[model samples]
Target: MKKQTKKGAAASRDERRMQQVFHALSAPPRRAILKYLAASSLTAGEISSRFDMAKPSVSQHLTILKTAGLVSRDKRGQYVHYALVKQTVETALMGLLTDLGAMPPAAEDKPLAEQDPSSPTAGRARKSGVATETDLPPAEKPAPAQMSMF
Candidate 1:
C-alpha cells in the first residue's frame, strides 16, 4: 500500500538523520563547536580562533554539524555565523533513547540533584551496603592510587 511505502521512506530518512547526528557527535572538535554555538552564535573565524587547528578543518567540522541538523548557518555580508539547533539535537538524541527503551520513567518528578538527600531513593546504593565515597569517614577514605609513568 502507498501508506506502507510512505512509512518506510520516512523511517529511512529518520535512520539517516540519526546516523548523521551520532557521527557529528563522535568528533571532539564538532562537540566543542556545538558547545561554543550553544552560548551564542559566532562567525566562522571566531570559532576557528578557539582551536589550534587550521580554519579549513574547523569549517569541515561545521559542515558536518550543519549536515546533521545540529547547527545552522547564516551569512551576513562576508561572514557566516553558526548557531546550535538545540531542539533538533535534543529530539534526535531523545528519539534514539526512546527507540532503545532507555528513557527514564516519567514518574521521576525531580532531577537527582534536586531530590532530598534524606529521601528513600537518594542513597539506595548506600542503603544496600554498597560503600560509596560519601559513606566513608574522612579518616577512613582511601587515597587515590597513582600509576607509574615508567
Candidate 2:
C-alpha cells in the first residue's frame, strides 16, 4: 500500500539519521566540540582557539556535526555561530535505546508536544516562550571537565 511505502521511507530516513549521529559522536574531537557548545553557542574561531588543532580540522568536525543534525549554524554578519541541537541528539539516543530494548517505546498515540509536560519534546514546544541556555550570554567558564556523558 502507499501508506506502508511512505512509512518504510520514513523509517529508512530515521535509520540513516541514527547512523549519522552515532558516527559524529564516535570522534573525540567532535565530542569535545559538543561539550563546548553545550555551555554556549560559539563562533568557529572561538571553538578552534580552545583546541590545539587547526581551524580547518575544527571546521571539518563542525561540518560532520551539522550533517548529523547534532549542531546548527547561524550566520551572524561575518561569523558563523554554532549551537548544539539538543532535541535531535536526545531523540537519536532515545530511539537507539528503544531499538536495543534498553528502554520502552514511547507512547505513540499522542503527539510529543501533547505528552508529559516535563518531557523534552514538550519543553521544546514551549521554547519560544522560555529563556533557554542559548538565550544567555556565552559562558566564560568552560564546561566542567569531569562532566559525565551519561
Candidate 3:
C-alpha cells in the first residue's frame, strides 16, 4: 500500500539521521566540543585552542557535528562561531531513551533508582541506606615506609 511505502520511507530517513548523530558523537574530542558549545558559542580558533589537536582535526569534527545537526556555525565578520543546537541533540537522545523503554522519570513519578531495583544506584542504596551523591569512592592513603640509616 502507498501508506506503508510512505511510512517505510520516513523510517529510513529517520534511521539515517540517527546514524549521522551517533557517528558524530562517537569520538571523545567531538563530545568534548559539544560540552564546550553547550556553555556558550565560541569562534573556531577559540575551540581549537581548548584542545591539543590540530586546527584541521578540530575543524573536521566541527564539520561532522554541523552535518549531524548538533551544531551550527555563524559568521561574525571574519570569524566563524560555533554553537550547540540543543534541541536536535536532546530530541535524538530522548528518542533513543524512549525506544529503550528507559526514558527518565518525570518529577511526579518515582525516581529511576527506586523504580528499578536492578539499577546500580539501587544496590548502593540498599548497602548504605541511601545513594551517595559523589561519583567516586573514598580514597585511602598509602602507609609511609619506615626509613633507617645504615
Per-candidate TM-score against the hidden true structure: 0.66, 0.71, 0.65
Give the alpha carbon lDDT tens digit for every residue of 42-150 in model 1. Answer: 9999999999999999999999999999999999999899999876776776676667777664523333322356644456543543334565456767888999999
Error of 2 at 106 (Å): 3.0
Task: List where candidate 1 sits over 4 angstroms from the true fold.
Answer: 1-4, 104-150
Report every candidate's CA lDDT: 0.79, 0.81, 0.80
Can you rank all candidates by TM-score, best first?
2, 1, 3
Clashing pairs in 2: none
Candidate 3 lDDT for residue 62: 97
Which 10 residues in a row give candidate 3 its minimum summed lDDT? 104-113
lDDT of 2 at 20: 96
lDDT of 2 by residue, 1-150 (tens): 345588899988988998999999999999999999999999999999999998999999999999999999999999999999987876776677667887656633333343466644455655564334443335633465786789
- For 8-85, candidate 3 gives per-residue lDDT tens digits of 999999889989999999999999999999889999999999999899999999999999999999999999999998
- Full ranking by lDDT: 2, 3, 1
Among these predicted structures, which one has the highest TM-score? 2
Task: Give lDDT: candidate 3, residue 138.
Answer: 44
Please tell me which model should have the higher lDDT, number 1 or number 2.
Answer: 2
Q: What local lDDT does model 1 show for residue 55?
A: 90
